[model samples]
Target: MADLVDSFTPSDPSDKSPFTFLNRLPTKRLDAKITRAAESGIPQQGAQTGGYTPSYLYLSHVPLFPLYSDRQHELLAKEDKHKQLMIKAMNDADPDKKLTGGQKAFLGTIGHLVGAGSIVSTQRWERRLVGSNVMSADSRMKQDKLLIFTRWTVPAPPGRQRQGPLWFVDVLEQRYDESSTSSLKSLSGNATMLKVGVADGRKVTLQLLKTEAKGIKTQKMWSKGTKTDTCEAMTFVGDNEIVAMEIVARIERTASMVEAMEVRKRFDKEWLVPMVQ
Candidate 1:
């Protein structure tokens, strides 16, 4: 992961190209749109008609709470069933003994364990299993502080079929630190593990078990053949890699801006042509 990070070449901060790697990410683009709308000097509408005017449709990106895909919904249902069954078993064992908080927590962990093992079978399925939502300031702040790389999932492109190498995007959610026996945790003791919130209100424990630069061959919309681009990739650590890369890039850009400002300040402080003395 460190090697991959070291190998990354930061994009130009001043470049206004929307095709830039970060800008290309769906969530990043959505985030940018929201930010632009907020900054634009347009008069906001009344609460009765929704916050922004009808023109600003992208602002309405908030997901309904407990967002779940069909599979996630099924998993959740199974977990609920498991909990109910456990509770029933406890009741059957001893009618006098009430269910304790600890026991309930245990049952919840067991349920997640059962679900996590069956998250997805292949990378394609993994991409489909994930979903997207609006990135929140709070979530972004948390990710910026804790992770060296930004974590993101490569959501399947719109429509039935798509091609090309899967590029990772940073998930704008908080890290999961629930339980030691959590299914999100890496089974191997040697692997670095972190349970992170992904799309669809789902939490996944990713293990830093693999790292490689994947060559993504993408065909242009109008051009022929394919363009092979080397994408720095990692198994579960892609989030961390992106986070670190962006953070470093941000810091560098900020420093350059500050330096330029300071240089201007210094020039102003010193007489350019003897200060009209």
Candidate 2:
């Protein structure tokens, strides 16, 4: 999938954040337009000889505890039923249930195994997932003029169908045309993957991925120091891609051995999973 965003190369390679962190962020006030962010990325001016301002995208990471999907809920229910069955079997004291002394010893071993496995605990939250500030901070700190680029992490819950977190995900596709003073949902679908291309060109082949921004909410926030309006959105980071990959690994470790096992099994199956197992 075309990564919706190209990860940023830090101005200071030592800093792990995918953005350039200035000792003091520049105070120049520029509207969220491609013409303004040119100090960092490509210059949109003049290049549009007979043309106009280009587009910009804002993407940054935020720690999240994703809500369990419906399928995951079903799995938990099945596992719970089996657990009750196992508990009853372990404690049965009838003559048939009352095992010989040897059977009693075996039951003790089974109990220990159950205790060890019970740590496969998982957690969930209202689809709010993580705080909005944490989600947008990096992006707000990165580009001068920002245009948020997002991918739906998941559909919004029914009650919040309109003007809610889900609505922000839809905004990702609404490209703003400064000249027209309007916006439109672009059909140039493949625009997300281009290394570089003329956007107006038709037949764009776009690459896509499931960015962990399932229930994103973007809004105007006051930058207390500057007190200017800002845009923010949620983003995902998987392990093995950046130095922060270590963090994703650690979150899984504390969450569950099973979760860690599952992570290794799926992502680094040949290497880390076997070592842990």
Candidate 3:
């Protein structure tokens, strides 16, 4: 017993023994190279491009979210039934009773996960360019003119088809003189006129009117102080007369002119600017 105890006894701190290998190991230094290498493992960011561009330049590459299809809906229903069964199992005390908070949260998270994995077709707006004839007419106009065509889907009015939403295509053109420095000076002078204001509802109303009219185009100065205040020619196509009238009526019924202007701004930014490159 004495010999066994001696063989198993711990060595002195200064003594070299089989276990001393651990003590001899060097502490790792915090090398900047190692830190940098670890940091390189993180994602590298690329340059970010923001703001609007012509639709013709990048519309085809835009990603679209697809609506749920009938088959997907059916599968979702089945999944829901399965979830209900599992929830009942989790709370066997009363199968028909409402789920407890914990069970509901668990099931809701699972539903989202399953839904994410399901397959569905995607959709994006169609886009093109118009007024090519004018662009080709003169080199000077070519430098100043930009025309973009794009369409966005809106919920169909009641009693319309459910397969897809209604699509409204808008043609927007931007024109400015590049050769003249005075043009830039004028823009700088009227900079405050470019401020966005809610009282600018008439501008959209007038633009809508020009869109409804045939063979007539209107150009306005930027002194209007609205985002849509910029000088441009616009036209709306592929809108059903009845639906267009209904939509216009809805806008006209907005609580106040300010609300209407806000709605207009929101729609342009969300639906129009996204088409820009």
The Cα local distance difference test for each model comes to 0.26, 0.23, 0.26
Runs in model 3 with CA error above 4 Å? 1-143, 146-150, 157-172, 177-207, 213-241, 244-277
In candidate 1, what residue range of length 10 has the lowest lDDT sum?
246-255
lDDT of 1 by residue, 98-120 (tens): 44667545443553445321221
Q: Say which candidate scores most in lDDT.
A: 3
lDDT of 3 by residue, 1-277 (tens): 2321111222243446433332233212212222222222211111212222343223445432111123433443443454344333333332113455675455445533453111110000000011111112111211222222222223345786643322222323222323433233244211111111122222322233323332222122222222233323333333343223211100011011122223334334443222221
Candidate 2, residues 43-132: lDDT per residue as tens digits?
Answer: 121111111112111212331222112443344345344434433432332222344667545444553444311111000011111212
Model 1 lDDT, residue 255, Cα: 14
TM-score winner between 1 and 2, please give it.
1
Instruction: Name the regions of candidate 2 deviating beyond 4 angstroms.
Output: 1-57, 60-68, 94-254, 258-277
Ranking by lDDT: 3, 1, 2
Q: What is the C-alpha local distance difference test score of candidate 3?
A: 0.26
Evaluate model 3: give its TM-score.
0.19
Per-residue error at 221 for model 3, in Å? 26
Residue 178 of model 3: what lDDT?
Answer: 33
